[model samples]
Target: MIHDVAIVGAGMAGASLAAAIGPRARVLLLEAEDMPGRHATGRSAAFWSETYGGPAVQPLTTASGPALRDGGYLTPLGSLHVGRAEDDARIERLLADFAGSGVELSRVDPAAHIPGLRPEWVRGVREPSCAYIDVAALHADYLAAAKAAGAEIRTDAAVTGAGRRDGVWHLETRAGLFSARLLVDAAGAWADEVAKLAGVAPIGITPYRRTMVQLRTDPPAPEGLPHVVDIAGNFYFKPEAGGRLWLTPHDESPSAACDIAPEEWDVAVAIDRLEKVVDWRVEAVERRWAGLRSFAPDRAPVYGFDPKTPGFFWCAGQGGFGIQTAPAASAMAAALLLGEGGVPEGLDAERYGAGRFPAMR
Candidate 1:
């Protein structure tokens, strides 16, 4: 069947894109896995901090705040960053860099909030505007909206090849062949591979491995506990749905595209570091898993059409901020594909466009 847009990979990006494009365009959302969000989107820390990404990316985060808050996906959880005395300068610089970005933050004595944490651990800052996102709910909401908008979503439909024919895209999949006027590549880690299949130059998108472990705590549920992150980003822990806590060593090792597994060494490193920063004890590990976070060479998201390819659009390299930035980024992708006037109001697409990485070509 031929659609107006054939979206590859039904992760948060593709799902949200399908929703944003709506009934205005005939959209076909495809996923390779049996379920959607089986990759990076499913494995996120589920945070929505406005000051999370670089300066250029902050606008998208800011613009996405309303949807995240009003859509019933966000809950205030706050975020805290601890650094040793030696790391004071970097921590201060980070705070200064994000001064007026709307992330409410302040420097506090670490020992006061964290009983056993030493004074040295309090050298950094805290961001009160940070919140935990209901990732599953967010993705599900987008999927439901997309479906209601007349977008067709297909799972277990992997695109093996994509080519241009008569000014349209011919996508070959195990399920069947489909055609579309435009092709949207939201394949996450396989984004570069998808571009290659479509005769577009690979954008040097590299996927990095990140591991997380969920641990059972003694009691109290740690209800008001905020996400604690090392100033150096060595490790981070946030309270989970129940009394459990999700922890990670924040490893960003380069890896090939595949189902990522947790390395014992990485898990050990997280445990060792986490123990030093908190008074609580990790009784047992309930689960351990890993996922791939793909990035462009510049570490920012890539959203727009390929300069060389007429109808092929690129919406990849969201890195770890895919969940939080999905709303705005998807809107940006739809706007660019439809060639609409200047990205709804506050978003600056020029910064995140695929053309930003000329060196990658």
Candidate 2:
């Protein structure tokens, strides 16, 4: 098969990139699993908030707002941050830092709003702009848009090797061999390994494990409930589709690149934190799971061609913000690979490009 661009991994990053370049170029999207988003993408907390990541990632989140709203991928779920008395300063800093970023937040005593929440254990900051994302629908929409624009997608087509030959890149996958003018690495946790196969220098991408547990409760949760995070981010809980609540300890332990599973210790930690904040009693744990969040040395995404490897491009190191930044990140990746003058209106490539990590080069 011959294509203009061959993309590895079919998560948000790869799928969105294929969608962006679909009209202008022939794209081949390859996924290792039987279905796309089988790993971290499928296990996301699925919330969109500009204040989640720091200033560096705020631009991408801001740029994606329009698309998220217009595409009907967001539901107004709001968000709250609760801290103990000692965390008042951190709460203040969070509010002050994100004020200019369009995050509307206010401080309040826990007793004023959350009667069940222990007053001695909590102080609260609320942001009305936070919302829940329809992750499955959003991913499907991107795939549909890419297919509609004439891009080819193949599942279980894991790329085993990639190399330049006769001024073109040859990608060997489980299904078959593909030739392309350019190759893109969007393999998430395995990004560095993919780069090694393509003869590109490793970029120090590390995958961290995060676990979440679902608990069932009586009385059901109120509709339109906001997502809540502890001031220390030790734990968070959000209402799910049914009467259950999805909770996490916000744990980010260093992990090997693989299909991660939740640890008993981590689950215990989450339960302990949840018990300290709210008065709700957990009847039972419905389920538990874990996923990997990959990060580069600087904790920023890398989007550009490899300096030493011709016809090889990078679009990795997204961490947990992959879904939120997909739109702009994909556009930026495609534009840079095509040698376009600059990134799209809202995104600046200088901060996100591979050049920022000279040590990687």
Candidate 3:
């Protein structure tokens, strides 16, 4: 049986898109792993911060707030951007750029907010509207909803080959063969590969490694501590349960698509950077893991159908904002998939279209 749409990946992007499109189409959400979200979606330190994706992505993030809250996926948490006294220019630029962006940002004394802030780190911006995303819950809900909507979800069904004949896509996977009218490339870091399998030009959606380490600290990380981030992208940290802190060096080393593991050097760099920001002592490193954050050349997400490929859709390059922007992004993607009627009310669709990529064009 030929499905209306078959989405590759089954991570946040594919799962959410399935939930949105299943009501209108016969959908298939496919995953290579035995379970969905074992890649980037499962390993994200997700927070709904308007400042996280810069100006281009702020609109999508902002528009998604209501839906996320309604779904019980967002938990209130302030996002603090701190920097040294010498980094005052960074703070000024952030304030000026987002002055009217509706992010609820404000200047504040860094020391007052963080217990062990360094003396020289006096400048800061706080996004009071930011909140932590329950990624696991969100992913599960999207998958479940898609299933409820009559979308077929298949795990361990890795796509080995794809082709089109007589206006239909024939996909060969480890599990079995499936046919569809449209193929959506939502395969996180492997999206480009999926396109290649379908004889579509690759969009240069490169993946980068992001490392996160959980550390046991002295004085115990405050449960109420805001999500602390360095404006210059050196480091970010927030409290985890059991007095541990989830820390990252904000590292973005380029890598190929695969199961990623944290580099020892990157882990050490995170600890070092965190030490400079906070006076807390790292008693021990409890755990360290890494995930791939894929991006297009422009560092913005790519949505919409491929300009040249007849039945292929581009839904990759979400970077780190996939979870935060999932609600609106999926809605926009669904509208694009179903023609032009339900375009999420306020989102500008042209910015993320596949036509923007010279290679795809």
* TM-score, per-candidate, Cα-based: 0.96, 0.95, 0.98
**Residue by residue across 1-361, what tens digits does model 1's lDDT show?**
6799999999999999999997689999989999999989898889988767666677788788888898888889888888898898878777888888766779987665554565457575888888899999999989999999999888999999888989899999877899999999999999999889888899999999999999886652377788888888788888887788899999999998888998999888888887787767778888999999999998889998888888988898988888898888887888888887547578878788888777534
lDDT for model 2 comes to 0.85
Estimate the overall C-alpha local distance difference test score of candidate 1: 0.85
lDDT of 1 at 33: 92
Can you write out model 3's per-residue Cα lDDT over 1-361, one digit (the tens) per residue? 9999999999999999999988889999889999999999999987788888788888889889999999888888898999887888898888887878777888899888889887888888888888889999999999999999999999999999999999899999998999999999999999999899999999899999999999999878987789999988899998877878999999999999999999999999999998888899999999999999999999999999999989899999999999999999999999998895688867999999999977777
Model 3, TM vs. native: 0.98
Runs with alpha carbons beyond 4 Å of true place in candidate 2:
218-220
lDDT of 2 by residue, 1-361 (tens): 5899989999999999989889999999999999999998999999998777667787888788888899899889888888888998888889778877676788766555543677676678887778899899989888988999999999989889988988798988998898999899999999999999988889999999999999875545546657888777688888888877899999999898898999999998988887787777888899999999999998988888777778888899999899988877777777898877557686788788776787656
Task: After superposing candidate 3 on the true structure, give the runs of residues whose Cα lies further than 4 Å from its correct spot.
Answer: none
Candidate 1 at residue 275, lDDT? 78
Of the candidates shown, which would achieve the greatest TM-score relative to the real structure?
3
* TM-score winner, 1 or 3: 3
lDDT of 1 at 301: 91
Tell me the TM-score of model 1: 0.96
Q: What's the distance in Å from true for residue 21, model 1?
A: 0.2
